[model samples]
Target: MNNFYKNYSGIILLLGGIILGSIAGLVFGKDVVALKPIGDIFLNLLFTAVIPLVFFSVASAIAGISKTNKLSRMMGIMVIVFLATVLISAFLTIMAVRLFPIHEQLQALKITEKIEDKPLADQLTQLFTTDEFYQLLSRRSMLAMIIFSVLIGFATLRAREKASGFVRFLNEGNEVFKHVFILIMKLGPIGLGAYFAYQVGVFGPQLFGAYAKSLGLYYGFGIFYFFALFSVYAFVAGGIRGFKRYWANNIIPSATAIGTCSSIANIPANLNAAKKIGVPDYITNVTIPLGATLHKDGSSISSIVKMAVVFALFGRDFNSADAILLALGMTVLVSIVEGGIPNGGYVGELLFISAYGFPPEALPPAMIIGTLVDPLATLLNSTGDTVAAMLVARFSEGKNWMDVKEAA
Candidate 1:
């Protein structure tokens, strides 16, 4: 029974939640108001473990790196790969949005009045102001949290003899936190059910139609965009044959992430897939774990795409300069600066919107759009991580394409 549950639990929970939520929504559509608190509670519970979990995981993982030089090299490659993928995703999303504009009969969708765009300097000032800065960090802002975690981790590593006992304690604590996280994740079905039920009850079927057309387009575009990006990494690391085999082995992890919409929860599967694809244990253990935190191709793409969608909704055309700048800037910013901190997506989205001067009312709609695309985003992010792991393995093994092919 334990083995059976381990094998099929995610699928059962996800489908069951969707089906039950749909039924409950149909029956209690008018009473969604009552379900709001339940959904909120689930979200609160889900996020409650994020901070401690991240702090320990990151600190331990970094401190556990045996050597500073190897750690730096691994991180360097990871950063480069992360940035490249993000840029490609962002560019593809921008093009797709332009070609398949979300609003065709733009006149139908009400355009909220534009807010005054904040200057970059002012926004930076606000971002760094002591109170605001503390709030961002306290809230587990992914970017800030990551920065703090990395600093502490590095400091702990340098402390070496002085902090050996403390580091050991943190490593143990990280493991304990992971166990707690696993326990919480097992309750995902209930939380998803409650959240979905609330959404259905509050909005009814009418809400589906509201952004159905735009969402459909975005989903289709995202699918194409992801495949294109995946292909590039596969080809660079290995040829078509290698790529096919690599992808086949990775399907389980990719599929799980898509269904669960949580990369962290899918880490075990991802690690397994990496090893299956011949990625070394060292590379897989380190890169895959870290990638789960920092490499969010899906989130980055969706953010840029949503920005374009918002622009279209407001009947504003993004000229080439604006489009290129937004895509490149967002990709670079998200890849390097955005830490795999808890609730990083929401924080990044809010900051993006505020910086661009998008209307306040636009946030709700943007969030709604994000929910629909989040699964795909998770898929892209997980897939990208696998690909990066493959690259790292290739480089570390000192194997060329010919060598890889011959080995296969």
Candidate 2:
């Protein structure tokens, strides 16, 4: 029963939200716009907690690492896997979008533009200059935050005794922030309902149908993309049997993520899944929590694919240089920097458009599109977490689980 609840809670919430949203739209209709501020308040509450939560959690995790070499190896493997997963997911999504082609003949939606324009040269300069560069690297901007967190974690280790007190404080702070995050998550369904209603009320449900086929295609591709990448990683690290066991245990986390469309909210379920899969507490404590914030396979895929679609929408043929730059830029910004925050991907997409000097009017439509797609992406992201945790556990145990299974 406990396992069933975990596995199905997300589906229940998602279905509930949709039902409620549709009812709200039918009744209140245009008046649903009034709910915008309430939804915004919830989003603000979630966002307000992100920066501190990230800093403390990362710092404490780093401080807890007892051996520099072990930490380095773990981090090396984590980064490589993260990037590779993201790139593969992105490549597949791009292909799906091209082949399936959502809204091929539909006119672009006109909405209030939130993007800021700059000359192409200026945009390039912004991407490279020291101040802007640091923003991306440090993740003070969405793209820089992950880089900054990793650096701070490593630096805390170097600080050793000098930073011990600070590290302890960070740990304490992480606990407090976690409590706050929980409080916000409890209100998520309501927030989602309100936001969805407001969106439908303002734009009308017809808008979704305008690209309904595309949206459906996106979701379908996202599901396949997740399983394909995770299957390979699981087989490589955990063997087929271990992989099967891992998935069996992780159903709840995957369901919860799909329902809530928030990876952070799925942390408890993920940790529980990790424990059930026989991962060490230290590994689960460190990786699951960190993964909630930094590992965003689903969001990375969506961001990259969306960017490609956006370019195609504008009838701009992407040259090799353009595609490479955009992919690298997105890999840094979407996958790493904005990995953990609630609605982080939506904000990152806006920044991507702004930084690229795309028309500001594109933002509102992008937001609308991204919001609709986020839940599906979040599900994929959570599934990736399970796959990653299993792999990490296999590697850390210093046994070739995959080979053992093969021999069996």
By TM-score, the best candidate is 2
- Of candidate 2, the 10-residue stretch with the lowest lDDT total is 137-146
Candidate 1 TM-score versus the reference: 0.65
The TM-score obtained by model 2 is 0.66
Q: What is the TM-score of each candidate against the true structure?
A: 0.65, 0.66
**Whole-model lDDT, candidate 1?**
0.63
Any runs in candidate 2 off by more than 4 Å, and if so which?
1-69, 103-124, 131-157, 160-210, 312-321, 339-342, 396-399, 402-408
Candidate 2 residues 1-408, lDDT tens each?
776556445445644775587578767888998876766776666556655665566666666667656566776666666676777777766667668766455444334434444455665555544365435422224324444556788888888889888788877987898677667756656766677677667656654554465567777877776667677777776677666877788678877886666788888898888777666666677677767766777777667656655654444443345554566556555654454444556545645664455553344345445656777778877768767777776776655644543444
Error of 2 at 327 (Å): 3.1
> For candidate 1, what's the RMSD?
6.1
lDDT of 1 by residue, 149-220 (tens): 678888998888899998998889877876676676566556656666665665565435446766776678
Which ranges in model 1 have alpha carbons more than 4 Å from their true place?
A: 1-66, 103-114, 121-153, 160-210, 310-362, 396-408
